[model samples]
Target: MQREDNFTFLTEEPIPKVIGTMAVPTIISMLISNLYNIVDTYFVGQIDTQATAAVGIVFSLMFFIQAFSFFFGNGSGNYISRQLGARNRESAEQMASTALGYTLIFSIVLVVLGLLFLDEISVILGSTPTILPYTRQYLGFSLLGTPFLMCTLCMNNQMRFQGYARYSMYGIIVGALLNCMLDPLFIFGLDMGIRGAAIATVIGQIVGFAVMFRMSLHKDIIHYTPRNFSHRWLFVKEIIAGGTPSISRQGLASIATIALNVSASQFGDAAIAAMSIVNRIVMFIFSVIIGLGQGYQPMCGFSYGARHYERVKAGFWFCVKVGTAFLLFWSVVLFAFSDRAIGLFRNDVDVISIGIPALRYQLLSFPFWSFMIMANMMMQTCRKTLQANILAASRQGLFFIPLILVLPHCFGLLGVEICQACSDFVSLLVTIPIVFSAFREMHV
Candidate 1:
């Protein structure tokens, strides 16, 4: 009875309500997090166009940081969630501790190296002549906080595995609110400009880290302590094996951003800012679906672990319906307000003109992109690693890279704007067979 009670994915209730209960808090958390990013961009934009470009360039670096964090965080969380579902607390503790410890150590190393190579890193991220100074000021302080940043992600994921999404949401909410408040105060009240915006971000993240760590320290089914961690090669190997797909996904995203920045430089600084704004806006709108997909992941993982194939099928279909509806609604919102939306980030007439059309094109892909994302999430949760990796690689990986290269040559800037949406449409078509096949053999 106790084991059954602990197993959320084993619930025999209708899948929609069960998935909704789990997904709503997660969606709220992601939406708030996305709002913080938008706020970061908005406040920074007030400084200057150079400052805005700096935000975009530095964001690519942050994605690289998140890639490492997600690798360990998701890998560990996936295993731990299943263990907890099966009522095995000890193994969960070990995995949780190992992930936390590695994140801290890795974050420190990344921060030290990032600080040391600050200038070169900034240049490689495609900082323009005018944008370089502001980029340094923002990226430099942010590096010092990298350890906290990485640990925060691990803690958040660990908590989510424990089915404590509300606590995770609280930490992120407080952090976002703090950041939003400080952005205006630091930038305008203190007259500190770009550096102030960076400071605000660091301070806000520190608050989030503090809150998440506190929530994580409770006497739960899974706990994180250095003593419980293992130095065994197999444990590390397993974690890496499970996490490699995520590393490829997020790492490739970071690389793709760098490539995009380098490519856009030929067009000019406005091009970088314009595309950056478009990406941020797309991310903001997509957060709800991504959150719902994340909510579905643990359900899929635990159900697969227990061989509860019917529940897995139910949850998978539930997620697809929810994701489709949410994305479709937001796509309309974005399309209707794209011009005003892009203007919030910049006042440049040229930037707005290019950005509005690009933002619309990017958003047009979301309704279908939701299907691709949910499909990939389902594959990962079920440990269908090869399928997961392929799906993960499709959007910005194999498809986008080729499309990005070829389309620009063929159609110029409009090609760049429309390529991702076109690629997403094609990716969804490719995903149909795989998704349905998984559903067809839903019984374990």
Candidate 2:
């Protein structure tokens, strides 16, 4: 009965209301998930600047983990939503189980490979001699939690795509809150330093995975059974089509972070630390818009599959307006308090000085992200894989990679400061035409 009602609610609810209902839980979940980093950065900062920088250095690995999780989650979730929209429960169940099966396999591989290459991976992630020990200590423990973290994130996306975002939020909130609570205990109370922080994170992820896995067994939600798992070419094609945009977006983000770190390393540890703080702050702000887009994704997938093109367009425009307004307000707030915001994570004078300009520059481009992100989400959900993949790659891959490489050489430290802002502007321009073309094709 609830499942039937969900279909009715998704299809028949007013656009704004439907999106609002969905967006709240998703926004909360995104915020909590980001707190894993924000909280870790804060607690670890208490030890010393190098410890904080170590967390930042290992952040790219976190991004790499998320890239694959999103690949499987978004791919399977999008397909599941479309199949559910078409009233095909069997197909949806199969995709869900298949995604879960592959997620576990891939995550185990990551853990083994990551642990085996721990030292090399640390160097590649831009860990300096001063930060290397802390990096290895923190990263090794984090790798152990890879399976739990990846599986939890994968299940979270699948649940949200099924319109069970509230249940998803419960699991994430529990984990994030546990991490927050344990951070002080492990980092300061136990005197374990950075190692404690890593332990807390792994424990939190393990618990979160347990909660979400239990939720997955609920009758209304699709259960992941062995019988439903498959490696058929048809399932693989669908997953790839649905998931590739996320891979491009998130995978490129990891690459972009590594590039930023390498460029900043030339200027010394202060530069790396400052830029790392700025990136975390920006990502926290950006997560709001991403959550808004996630809320709209299921609506887009269902409506598009059901041929309700008008609802898809309505949800897209609504999200863009709301998301842009939110960013506009926060950008101004952060710009005014740039020093304090950066200082909140690390109070070093060098870190604060370098972070202020970079944070402000990034904010200048924040308002434009709403349209760019929403458009990409819309295209991906509608199965415009090529356009979606192009848009996904534009910000971090196509534009940012080139600018980060060239600008720092030409302008020194200032180039690192403004590179992301420049990339955001160019990505927005590229997104405009692709989105327009997408809408015209839909006759919207």
Name the candidate that leads on lDDT: 2
Q: Could you tell me every candidate's TM-score relative to the true structure? A: 0.95, 0.99
Write out the backbone clash pairs for model 1. Answer: none
lDDT of 1: 0.79
Candidate 1 ranges beyond 4 A from true positions: 1-4, 8-10
lDDT of 1 by residue, 266-338 (tens): 6788888899899898887777877888777767767767688888877877787877887888889889998
TM-score of candidate 2 relative to the true fold: 0.99
Angstrom error at residue 185, model 1: 1.2
Models, CA RMSD each: 1.8, 0.9
What value of lDDT does candidate 2 attain over all alpha carbons? Answer: 0.92
Clashing pairs for predicted structure model 2, backbone only:
none
TM-score of candidate 1 relative to the true fold:
0.95
Superposed by TM-score, candidate 2 places the C-alpha of residue 52 at a distance from the truth, in angstroms, of 0.8
